[model samples]
Target: MIRLPSPAGRRQFGVAVAGVLAFLGQPVPLTAQGFCFHPGPIARCSWFSVTEAGVALSVPSDEDPNLTFQAGALANVGPRSAVGGVLVGAVFQNDVRLGVRARYRRWLTDRLTLDVAPGILLYNGTFTADSPGFTGELALGYADWLGMTAQLDVVPFEFGTET
Candidate 1:
């Protein structure tokens, strides 16, 4: 049987949703709506460990926290749409998840953005089984990831968050 969140978990989720809604209601200047070359470092760490990791996901150990790096750029095709590409891999991983993907973004509000990228997994020279694999991301602001590599790999997509 499927279990739901505890009452406390539900309340926290509700509050978080409400906070996001409040942010969505506010507006920001859409000045930088062009080619945005954001190639930078992203660090990921997990506070908890899965004592019983399932088959879908694999990693070195508790020592190998989920992490990946991104080098990408997006140019707005219109007022609300954007297109780009990303390269993903090491520097952030104790292991590695390497891939490349095409990224797209849609401005929900001037301050809020949604990003989706789909790509191919080139290699993962570590615990995860390498194969005819895939990688991608679904994110808000493309920064604060709710489901990420270590924390968000619910699909055990071993999803590279940015690339």
Candidate 2:
């Protein structure tokens, strides 16, 4: 059975879609002089949906199961490279954790790609000094119609953290 999103969820989805469209609508120059070997049939200026309203099930190292919602948009900057941003949110401990990341992707092969994202993570209801932290993610994915991604995220710096 297909379950529908709640009112709030729907609102978030709408805003995400609008944001992606607005980003894509901006004028940007496309050059074929970038990376990628053996350029495929796709055009150099083509835009790909890196992620669109994707939902993930996550279980932290010492936490309960959580649901994550993510949305992103990327344009092919080169034959084998793309750049974009992903917005993610999770409901944990009755609070919403939100983050926005700038992503850079390099396609090792037509089916495999590496993504690196660095951005800010905000937890709890308010964005206090301690609530915001530096976070980054490294992901490898077999990108296709139905793709699989393995990702790891880490908090590099925190107010009370030791290296």
Candidate 3:
């Protein structure tokens, strides 16, 4: 049986998620660029270019103490936002999770960006939520190449084991 985390843990998770969302939701300027090159005398710049398109991998944990690996693809939807889907699996357990998320990125400076993602968990292994509980993530991106993220997921209802 999969046991949920303690009440304190849950509260902490909620607070963290709320904070991240609030921070990201603040009014910020859109400063992302379409191209990363300089146009020559005869070249014209495209107004809209796909800024980022890549796969991301992470090992995220919660108060439950289970280490899980999450892999997903991210595509740029706006200047500072991305949307993607992720598959999460426990490293030492048999549970699998799937989710879809939308991320908002805020540039802190020239090389640092604060990222916030909010989404829904479609599947949570044996224990599935009835009302479609939510998930949130906060990340720090550096130099457009490296990132670190913390995630919180809540699945309130369970629907037994999956065969």
Candidate 4:
């Protein structure tokens, strides 16, 4: 059996749709003429982990402390422009984060790419922290990611080589 939403639920759905359209930079047009739409090339998705040890301020601490776990997706806006959204969760505590970034990637070589993303971070936990900053990364791709987060031993044909 299937159930339908009430009138209030329908109204809420319309509002959510409107918000999404606004974010995508589409004009709210009641009537329009012919418009050319091109989505262009799509950026590849990548995953990375941050785990390091030692600090100058601290004499000793947990070796290779697990600080954070993040997962996100990257979308290519143009040949060199990309954008992404990420969710971060603390490994040792109950801290959660949500962030979005505008990025630009340069193809250094046929198998290597460099990207820089600057954006804001929003978190909710014991001590809330918000940062508006930029982050950069260099990726060396042979084909795709291997041994990434899981042990699936699968080959991902996205975001690497054209083969």
RMSD to true structure for each model, in Å: 16.5, 8.5, 11.0, 15.8
Q: What are the TM-scores, per candidate, against the unseen true structure?
A: 0.47, 0.58, 0.47, 0.37
Ranking by TM-score: 2, 1, 3, 4
lDDT of 3 by residue, 121-162 (tens): 555666654444567878786776666766677766545322
lDDT of 1 by residue, 4-76 (tens): 3335434544554454345334433354332223311111110111111112224545543444566644445
Q: Candidate 2, after superposition: displacement of residue 105 in Å?
A: 0.9
Prediction-by-prediction clash tally: 2, 0, 0, 0
TM-score computed on alpha carbons, candidate 2: 0.58
Which segments of candidate 2 are over 4 A away from where they belong? 1-45, 52-60, 126-131, 144-163
Error of 2 at 143 (Å): 2.8
lDDT of 4 at 94: 34
lDDT of 2 at 48: 52
lDDT winner between candidates 2 and 4? 2
lDDT tens string, model 4, 1-163? 2223334434544554454334444332322221212211233322122221211111254434335443444344444443443333333333332333333444443334454544333322333322222222233332223111210111112243210
List the candidates ranked by lDDT, beginning with the highest: 2, 3, 1, 4
- Candidate with the greatest TM-score versus the true structure: 2
